[model samples]
Each structure stands twice: as C-alpha cells, then as structure tokens.
Target: MAHQASNIPWNVLASNLHWSELKHPGHGDLHLRFKPDQGKKLHYFVEAFIRNIREHSYTARKQYPEHYNPPLPEEVILDDAVVCKITPTVRRWRAQRKHPGFCRCGSGILRSEETEHKCECPIPIPPEERTAAAFYRRYEPNRCYMFFETNGKAFYNLEIVKTLLLYGEMDTIFRVCAYPGVDLRTWWSMYQCYCENPDAGWDSLCRTALLPYIALNVISCFPETWDSASGKTNEKDYRRMRIYQYMLKHCTKSGMTTEVATHPHRQFFGIADGQFKRYGTEFRGPGLHIPYPYGLMPLEAFLNWDQVVESKPAPADIPQVQWILHSKGLPMELVLEIMAFAGYAPRGRLQVPHDPFHPENREELAKYLRFCWEVLVRCDMMAVALGMAIPWRDLVSNTLVQLLSCVPRRWYTIPDDVDHPESYVFL
Candidate 1:
C-alpha cells in the first residue's frame, strides 16, 4: 500500500493473492509469501521474538533491552531443511475443526451445531465463498502464519496472533515478527529519510518497507467478526505502536479502528517535527512525527494545517483520495482526469462505487475504472470498494470473492498523548 512501483506489473500483481515481489523505496525488491498461523509455528515464534524485543508476551519480545541481548541470526531461524524436517501440525488442526456445512435454509450465513445454528441474512453465498476467512482460504486454503523471504531464505514473518475484545466488539491483534538479528529499530529510525540515501541501507532495513502490504495481505482475510486491530507495547515503544496504529487504519477501509495499549504513564511532550525534516520546536522526540494523516501521499496538497489535525478521526476523514493518488503513482493531471470522469469534485469526498465490478461502471469510464481497479488490487484496498457496497451478496457475481480482505467495524485515530501512555512517542 505504501511504495512506488518502479517496475511492478500492477495488472499481473493484482491477479495473484498468494505471493508478491515489489521494490520498496528502502528495501529494493522483496518476495513475500502468505502462510496461515497454523503450520510453521516456530517461524512465527521467531517473528514474535523480534517484534516484542523486550517484555516477553506470548506474541512479542522476551525481555527489556537492558536485560536481554537478542540471539544471533543463526540462533533465530532454521533454514528450509531444518524447517521442513519437522512435521507440520496444520493438517491435525484442520482435521480437528470440521467444516460447518451449509444449512438447508440456503442463506450464505454460517452457523454451528446444525440444530442450533441460525440464519438471519438470506444471502445464498456458496460454502467456499462465505466469510472473509473463506475468501483468504482460496489462497492459503491451508492455514499458515505468513512470512517474507528473499533468495529462498526467510526474511521475517507477520501474523494475526490474537483476537482482542474492545469498544464492545472484537479487534484483531497482529505483529510484524521482528528478530534481534534483523534490527527493525534500525529500519524504523531511517525509514522517513531513506529515499535521499535510500539505496545505501536497503539490505540492512530487513525489508521492513514491504511489511505494511504484507500485513494488509494477511489481515485482509480474517473473519468479519474480527473488526478492529489492536497493539500493545511498553511505554518506550509507543511511537512504533502509534505508527502501526495509523498504518493499519489507513490501509483498511473505513469503520476499522485501532487501539495501542500500554501501562499508565504521563505525557511528556517537548519537541516534534513535520514532514520532509520540518522541525518542531516543541521538541518531543524523533522517528517519524510528520503529523500527515495520510501515510505516504504527496504532501503538497495539505499545506494548510488549519484543515487537518493529528487526531483519532483524522485518518479516515476522506479515505480514498490520498491512498488512491499514492498507490496509483499516476501523474497529477492523469489522476485529475480520472477523478473528473468518475464525478468526484476537487477536494470533495471521493465517490465509492455502488457496485465496483458492475457492468454499468464499464459503460462509462471503462479505461479509467479499469485503472482504479488496478490501483485497488495493487494496494490491496479492494475492501474500500467492497465496503461501500456493504451487502456484498447483492452484487452481480460471487467471482469478486477472491479479491476480498478484512473489514474493520468503523474507524481509527491516534489516542491522546496526555491520556494514553501508549501514545508516547520517542526520538
């Protein structure tokens, strides 16, 4: 969702849901493969170790930096031979969970305990086409925890490690499996300024740039019930926690909210900075504090700070415009023309198609719609389109199921720095 595709084939890339190879501004090119959270459980542990780094959680680091020096690279991961040697328990897990058969009522809605399952929605989606989980199953069909690889060796991994209940609904907690050997802290520190010295540190960044999309690819398939995404880190890592909070919100459709939690701590704001090295005299700390609501779009459009603020409601305020512009990477004029054809006014709310793949859309802006769809597929933002057309079953065909991703309940924003300790960022 964040990089420029210098040599990426948008059309072909959209067609494949399993794996992707894209050139990141900081990481050059990386090959990413998606696996369910079942098989390769040890590899999942490796990623968890890296991500947690300190204060070991079942899904994160083992100890604080002062007490624990992370293990060496050799100690972290097993090569293909060592990994393949161990028998995967995926089959056993899958075997244990029986497919809840479709009810005779014919509603696509899934129910458990045949006699007790209820069907409220009368939509007739085929068994395989049921939920977002089923949509992802089309790709990973086998349950796995996904990881990144280059040169046939594992680079890193990410997975939906747990489901949390928050704001009266379910939130999915995911991690970008970090390891001590790879140095994700290095990647985070230099990410914002890298384009200027981009090529020099590509390898050392551990391909962290591809992480956003890799995350988008995996979380996109979680069941609809897993609404928002949640994260937890110590007070020191709050900035990383906040940045991830925003990234997940921007990449997913509207209605998805994010909350990063930490133990109680008082806010200590001092200095801050804006995009492109614009320093903030307020002096808080440094990493990426460029308060631009949109992740990586052209900043020229938002010179007026009066219009936008860094708050909880900020990220999803407009939704499509910034992400579309960044992901498509099209010339400003071409983007304007496409938007004009689509009946969107300058700086107005971008129109969400009533039916994304509907024929009526093809009759008018045929080539332009095609380009927009390509952008959606490349950025894995099809949920933006599918979300607007809520009753996905009412649409023309079930074929669009393969293009599915996760749906968050509503929206996300940054927690107040004064109140939430997790919102504390550092330099």
Candidate 2:
C-alpha cells in the first residue's frame, strides 16, 4: 500500500497545481491502475474530486461574495480525504442505479416534483480558461486568436470557433456562422435550434458582424506571393474567395428578406398629410419603402445613382461623407477597399477574414482608379512625379478631405540623382 501510494503521480495527488497537471491528458489511462478490484476506481475518484471542488468554489463565490479564495485540494491530507470519499461511496453508487430525477449537473437529486431548486452547481470552466493553450497546440502558427474576452464578456470563445472553422460539419458551420450575437456558444446553440426548425426567423444584426469575419478568414487561403502579379498564383486563395463571395451574397439576401418581411410599416401622419402634400405630391403615392441592399460591396463597385444618372450630374450632387464627419458607423467596405487599393495585403486570411471584395468588377475598378488618383493628389505622391508641389485645395473638393486623410511630406523632393530603389518604393 505504501509503495502504491508513493508510485501515484504528483498530479493525481493534488488539485491547485498547474491546470495542465490537473487536467493531465493521461489521467484516464488504465496502466496507472493500482488494484484489479479497483478497476476504473481512480477515474471515478478524480471526477468526484473535481465535482466537489467545483461545488465548493460555487459556495465560496456565493457565500463570501466580497472575499473568497476558491478551495484547493492541493494539500496531501485533503487529496487523501477526497480519494477516500470517492472509492467506496461513489463506486458503490455507480454499482447501484443512478438516482432518478438527478439533475444532470451532478447536483443532488430533486427533493420532490413540487420542490423548487436552483441547482447551484458551478458554471463550466470557460473555454477561455479551460483551453487557452489548446489552440496553439492544435492549429497552424498563422491562425489568429482574436476572441479573447474584452471587459467581462467575450463575443466568441477560442475553442468553439476553432472547432467551427477547422472541423465542424458543413451545415453546422453555415448555420452558426450566420448567428447574430458575439457569443460563440450562443451562436452554436441558436444554430442547433435553427437547424432543428428552419421556419424560425433570422436575427439580422448577425450579418453586420459575421460578413467581415468571413472575409478576413478567406484571406488566409492567399499565399505569401498572393499580392504580387508575377509570382505563382495561389489557386486556394481564388477558390476560397469565390466561396466567400457566394456565401456572403446568399447570407445577405436571406437576412435582408427576413428583415424586410418582419419590419413594421410606418403609419402615414394623417394630421400632417395636407401640409406635407403642399411641398411634394410624392407623399400621396404608396408608402415609400427603400429596399435594403444585399451587402456593402467594394467601394468602387458600390452604385452611385446620382453620378450614374442618364443626365451627367454635377459633382456636387453626390451625398456628403457624413459618416466621417460624425466619426461613427464607418463602413467596413470603404476600409477594405482602401486597404486593397493601397497595396497592403493582409497577412493570412485570418487577419482580414470577411466577404470577397472584387477589384475586377467594372464599377469597382473605375472607383479604384479614381480613389488611386485621389490618394496620389491628397498624399502629394504626384508631386514627386511632377517635381513640384501643386496647391489645388480649391480645385479638389473640400469634402474629399473628410473621406481620405492627408499626411504632409516633403520626401517627394528627393533629388533626381538619388539612386535608392528602396526609398522610392513608397513614392
């Protein structure tokens, strides 16, 4: 007995040790068995020990409120006591039938059907805590872990996301990916529920956040040489981008349809109808409803009705960049287009996972060219090519300043004889 006790692993004898040790992967091995009669006894002991520790932790958190160090079974005597309590009593219970109406949480069985109980069992150790290092152990180095808790809440947890991105079933991934909230677990649960019943309505807000993440993820499929037009093209990037575009389009349409159908129509203001009609006859027509677009497309691809009208509209007819002025609700598409045009290809798909933004689309390409020119003028990059700075503040619309930031620089004045190829790259 003494030799067997001495041979027991340090991890099996303690709890407050490193969590890695407490959750030692080999703890389930039967090779560590002590006695033939005690078959699987150690496994039962460890589980019961853990359950007790969690219960104690909950009691401390609730009762002490202000100050409570979670109980530890690190002490040798405590481990001995826990081990002793589990083997005979817990093992005997296992031999007999499980108590009927036992709360699956491992809490005591329900007292009676009429009696109410809150089932004060502890919350599962959050994935952020349970599997902090699991991602590094399992995934490629380039994979980004962006779901860490900010403030007290996490929109997504690493484990569930890893599973969804790398190994989840196709249908499940699609369903969960469309969930609206930040919580991955909730997204997963809602996804399961949605799968079980397809008639339920979707939550539109999910698309607003999910699209960008999907786009960023697809970027990982791009290779190191992805940005260069010359080197070997990564077929994987192209395929993934195409898939992302299709999914995003489908998701946008589905979400939009649901939103439109459920949205409550506004009642016409009867009292003000006569006064409103004096200013415009358009008020007398059917209730005005602007159809929402599928998704925010690439900047250049986005339609500008005022600019595209059959009669060439004046430049001043376009809508002002009020979002920039307000410094709120900035469009993700605009930022993505800026990055694309600026030649700043993101590192891996994980860095900028979201829907595909096509530069090749005629409208997008035209916009890209215009923005490229605007960027050159605003940054004074053209001055380097011209050999002199041209002040055209009046000619350039002042509102353009609101959309693009200008950083003043004199580097363009480098002497013609300067031979540094590296320094001229930015110019």
Candidate 3:
C-alpha cells in the first residue's frame, strides 16, 4: 500500500511548528509555552546580572588597596527593554468564528455579550478573562525590535548584544551604554586594525591612521548599493583596496602591485599638490594626483612619523599585551611565547615569530607553553588540572572585575568632531 503526503505549505509549517515553541510533544500548548512577553524574561535576567556585577565591583574596591575603583553602578547600562513592533513578515489573520470562550465560574457556556443564556453566566466578561479575545483578534504577529545609540547611533540585534555581554567587550559595552554621545566607530575601527595586523605594529598604525581620514575625505567617491535611502552599502572591500593603493605610493614609497596599481581608478589624472612645496607654480600645478598617504596619522603615533612608522614595537612587546592576555584568562607566559615563536597573533597574524630559543628572549615562551598544556589540557590523566571548571572561563570574571576596577573613565572625553555629518561613517 502507498501512503499520500500531507499538502501543507512551507510557510504554514514554519509558523505553526516553530522548533522554539515545541520543546516536548503532548505536554502543553506550544503557543502558551512561548509567549510574546518572553523577551522580558531575558531583560530581567540581564538586570540581575548587572546587579551582581555591581555588588562584585563594590566588594573588589573595598578589599583592594589604593587606586582601585570599580565601575560605578551609573557607568554600566544595558537596556534590554525591547518594544514590540509590526514586522514586514506578515500572514493572513485566523478566523475567529470557532470560539473557545467559556464562563468565568467554569460551569456554563458563554455566547455573545447581548445574548441571554439559560445558565447564570454574567452578561459582560471581566477584563482579566478577556485575554483570549484580544490575542486572537490581532491579524499579524509582533516582533521584538532591539537597538542602542552611542555618540553616533549604533544599532544591534539580539544576537550581537548577547554575544558582547556574554563573552567579549564588557567594558566597551558599559562605556557605550553610559555615554551615548561618544563616537565608538573610530575605537572599533582601531580595534579591527589591531586584530588585522598584530605583528606589523607600524603597518597597522599607518593603516589605522590613514583609513579614517580617507573614509572622511572620500565619502562621495564610492559606488551605491543595497539601500540608497538608508545610505548603507556593501563597499568596505572597495574602500580597503583604495586605501591599500594609496599606502603603496606614499607610505611604503614603492610602486603598487600589478593587480592594484593598474586598476581603472589609479591613472585618473588631475591637478594636485607636490609633497614638500608650499608656494609657487610647483605647489598647485596640473599633474597626475598621487594621494599623499602619509597625511593621516593615528592619534597615538607619539614619536616622529618617519621613526615610528617602520620600527613600531610588536604587540607582545607592549606593556598592555599582558593585560589583554590576562583579561581572557589565558596562560600568558605560554601564550606569549607561542605567539612570538609561532607568529600566531589572534585576528592579526597567522604564523609564530622565528626566534623562540634566542638567549636574549627573556619572555620565557617555552616554559609557559608547557605550563598551559599541563593546566588546560593533558587529558591522558583522568585528573583535572586547575579547578574542576575550565581554567579560562573560571578566571575571566575575576580578570574583568580587576581590569574595570582600575580603568579610568575616558569614553566621555571623545570629541563630537568625529561624529560630524561629513564623515559619512555607517556603523
């Protein structure tokens, strides 16, 4: 005997049989189990989490010595109170003729309000008992809308907000929450540059300095994309290539690679200024424009541009490197050695440094690696090292508390000039 398949549509199946609502079969109604107010539960949990952080902060400041100050309760702000809004994804309204309405006393049938019944059912339904009618009357579903603003408004969905809070950037999160007027995009861009080129400190410095200025200066040069009204387009790749070409000509003082230099935009000739001349015909004469890449410099480039651009210290050499490693609760000595020898800077470089065994290398790379291997791994022995819980995860909370306790409030000082309309930075 052959069986026939059900003629259910995919959209109907998706809506009615949502996996999130159907936790277990034959237990309870799926709709009741996952109500629209579920997001409030998450909001409450985050509130409690912040309370705990505040308590911890207070205790750490009290117990520790001088210069130890926790992040003030006012400084940390996370607003999870999302509004319910009508979403674009709408479906047809359900028919309401099949009524499940019952009397309040559970002893009689409830008809329309005007209709007289044989049973002693009340003429009007109580406000509390009218929920079913209100819920079912709505034609379309509601969606939770989440967003937050900074100096220049930064918006995020549920996943991005949760990820930042749960794993990374607790300080950044709090700082932004507290100071909505601070421009966070530049700081984030700098962080990205750091992640991109961990080993080539000078290269990243130059790139970070130059990119923002270029972004501000050439806002109108890029092509349009997905949403013209919103002014958001997928053009970072095009901008990055343009910046790379500019760097080759001015910063590196080398001819551009064949693939980039010969691209359509490179030879677009125009009248421009020479590098040094400030006066006379040579300064503003008609010539092929070579965008002087060295014009932009990152705020932290303290030494002479020529001196610091090429000979910048590696990340491992920076004093703050240890703080970053410790913040993640990683085995620092081992990780640093591994990082230097293997050239594996997370999000920066892929390979380790070459001179691990050099006598002058006082960083103690090998021994640290051995300690980490034994503490974090070494699964051959049934016995767990460190605590029963994971080492990094266990230490991370304490590390964050420690770091936040000492951090000075600086986000408020960021100038509003970065948020100027001409920059055209879309987060």
Candidate 4:
C-alpha cells in the first residue's frame, strides 16, 4: 500500500515522503517515486535539498579559517570529503563540475571530516587571528628575505646601509645606528664588526649585502680586480667595470647633438637637413601634405581597395605595388589624382599605354600609385605620419564614400532598363 500510494499522481504525499528520501540516501527510501502530476512536490523536495547543502557548506568555512595549519590539516581533509561527494555524481553523469570545498556560511564546520562513526560538526575561528599567523610566515627572519623586512622604507635609509657594506666603512655604520628610527640595531653592529675584521664573524653579512648593493647603485665604490698573489687584474672583471664607468659618463650628458626639421602639419614627416634645401617650406623643411581634399577615408572603401589590389594579376616573381586613397569628405576624383601623384593605382581599366621606360608594368603601376594616395587619405595615414591627431572613424567613412563616387561612370554597368527601368540608377 505504501509503494502504491507513492506512485499516485498527487502532490501532498510526494512532498512529505519522496523529498526526505532523496536528501538522506541512508534513510530508508520511502518506497516512493513521483508521478507526472506530482512535479510540484518533487521540485519542492529538490529545492530543500539544495538549500540544506549550501547552508551546511557555509557553516563549515566559518569554523575553520586556519584550515591549512600542519597539525590539523583541516583544509586537506575537508577537500578530500568534498571530492568524494561531488566527483562520484559528476562521473556518473559524464559532466564536469567545479568542486565546492568547505562550507563558507560561518557555521564553522570548515575543519570537520566524517568518520565511520559520525561527521565532526563545524567549529568557527576568528578572522583576525588567521591574518596575523599568515603575516608571520612571510616576514620571518632570513637573510634572503630583505624585501619583506625593509617594507618600503625610504630609499635613502636602504642606500646608506648598502653603501657602508660595500666600502668596509665600520665606524660610519656605528654612527648611522646612533640615529633614531632604525630597527635591527644588533644586525647592523654585527655587520660593522665583520667589515673591520673579515675573520671576526661568519661571512654571511658581506655575501648577502655586498654584490646586490653595487648592482643597485647604492654603493659608488667599485671592486678591485687585482689578485694579490698574481699581481694582475682579472680581464673579465676589468671589462665589466669599464662598461659601468662609460655608462656613468654618458648619463651626465645634457642635450641632443643635432636638430631635425619637420613639416608643420605632419608630426613624423620630416626632411633631413640636406633634403630641406629642396623641399623646405619657409625655414623648416617640406610642409606635410594630404593627397585627399579632405582629411579621412571610409573603412569599408579602404578594405575594398585592399581586396581589389590583391586580386589584380601580376608577375609571379615581382613584388606587387600597393596603395590606398582617402577623402576626408571631398570628391573621390581629387583623392584619386592625389593617389596617382603619390605612386598608387585606382581601380578599373587603365587609359594610358604601358611605358617601357618605366621598370614597372605602367598600367598596373598607375593603378598602384592611385591606390597609395587612396590608402593615405582614407586611412588617415598622412595625419598620423605628420603627427596630427584626428578621429579615425570620420576619416575612413568620408574617404570611402568619396572614393566610391570617383569610380568612372563607364566602370559601373546599369542593369538593362527593359526589364525594370525603375530599379536601375546611374551614379
């Protein structure tokens, strides 16, 4: 009868029994399953199970904040249990799931692990205590760990200590220690003694601080290369020392040796001193010029130019000439002419005959030259090269529409008007 009632298509019984059965697998199954009509009850049972699991996990994390400590290793134990719970279900479903380890709800069960007899309940730890323990581990006393100990004290203080060690200046070290606000006085005194008598204490202080101080420029002193017994300097050390001397000399220099003249309109466009004589506008070199009447080109038209040029037939071995044209907002014909002057070709069949005198294919060459002007104006390269900062989008759109308009009327074929005269429009 219990089993028969469980199978009935209803809600009330489904919620009371089947939901509890799903949560505690160890608890005897209610010998119940949900029918289509009992979906609402089944949903309630699932929701309750999820809510209970989340609450339990949160409670665990709140309990064990110092979970990674050696003796307890609470973090490791909790992690293992979580793996057991989540991994089996994930594998069974053939789906990937991120493991949610430890309860974080402040219930303090973070340190608990289940035993054969029973599961250990959550125990909470104070947040402040955990933070102090972590800090101690990072900044503990060690020669190699200077970065943490110094903790960004003023650069001058660090440099003073570094300089003293490099020059064997023991008395100066003692004098500096007499001043206020310096921590670690014992270590400083020990280091000073080591400098005066090399054999007095362990050589650790000199080894730890000496080389790094020199490398960081805290010590102006340089190491001597001569070996006392051999009476000759080590060649390699001599070479490296000389390099540093050269660097110091150059670092003191004041200004540039020569000045180069540039075009007023373009930042990067400049003529060398010699070339300035021929092209100089006023006294400062050639004026930066834009091929297009306007300042920019359309991005779409630029892309079209790139595609069309790439598609044109050319010799297999010879490199192809590439160009771009742009118009800020002017007629495309003007932009095309500027491109031709700049050495680029415009799209469409060429009217001029191939000039044998020219090394390039004259027809293709003309198109390439026009193309270059198109790219400069359209891409706003002229502005960029000359160091003029202009908005990129407006430049691209204006240039593209202008270039499209410049296409020769003959190049665009209108569909036959016999079929639909209204549909065809000439540019």
List CA RMSD, all candidates: 26.1, 32.0, 32.5, 39.5
Sort by TM-score, best first: what order?
1, 2, 3, 4
My TM-score estimates for the predictions, one after another, are 0.18, 0.18, 0.16, 0.12
Segments of candidate 3 deviating more than 4 angstroms: 1-167, 171-243, 246-286, 293-427
TM-score of 2: 0.18
* Per-residue lDDT of candidate 1, residues 97-142 (tens digit): 1223222343323222111123332322332222223212111111
In order of listing, the candidates' clash counts read 30, 15, 15, 54
Lowest-sum lDDT 10-residue window in model 4: 258-267
lDDT of 2 at 400: 16
The best-first sequence of candidates by lDDT reads 4, 2, 3, 1
Question: How do the residues 1-427 of candidate 2 rate in per-residue lDDT, one tens digit apiece?
Answer: 0111222222332221111112223111011122343323323433333343334333433422332222222211112332333232222112121222112354433222111122432422222322322212221112122111121122122222322222212222222223233232222212212223321112222222223222222232232213444332333232222223233332222112111111110000001001111111111214423222111223122222112211221222222333353356657677556544553332112111221233323243233223222222222221221233322221121111111111223212223664532122111
Error of 4 at 195 (Å): 26
Stretch of 10 with least lDDT, candidate 2:
264-273
| Candidate 4 residue-wise lDDT, 1-427, digit = tens | 1111222222342232221223322221122333554434533432332243334334433433322222221212222333343332222111111112212343322111110111222322223212212112211232532422332222112322332232223323333333333343222222222223221111222222212212112111122222224322333122123222221111111111111101110111111112212111221214524222110122222222212213222232112232233325546677656645654432222222111112233444334323322222221221222233333222222221222222213212235653432222222
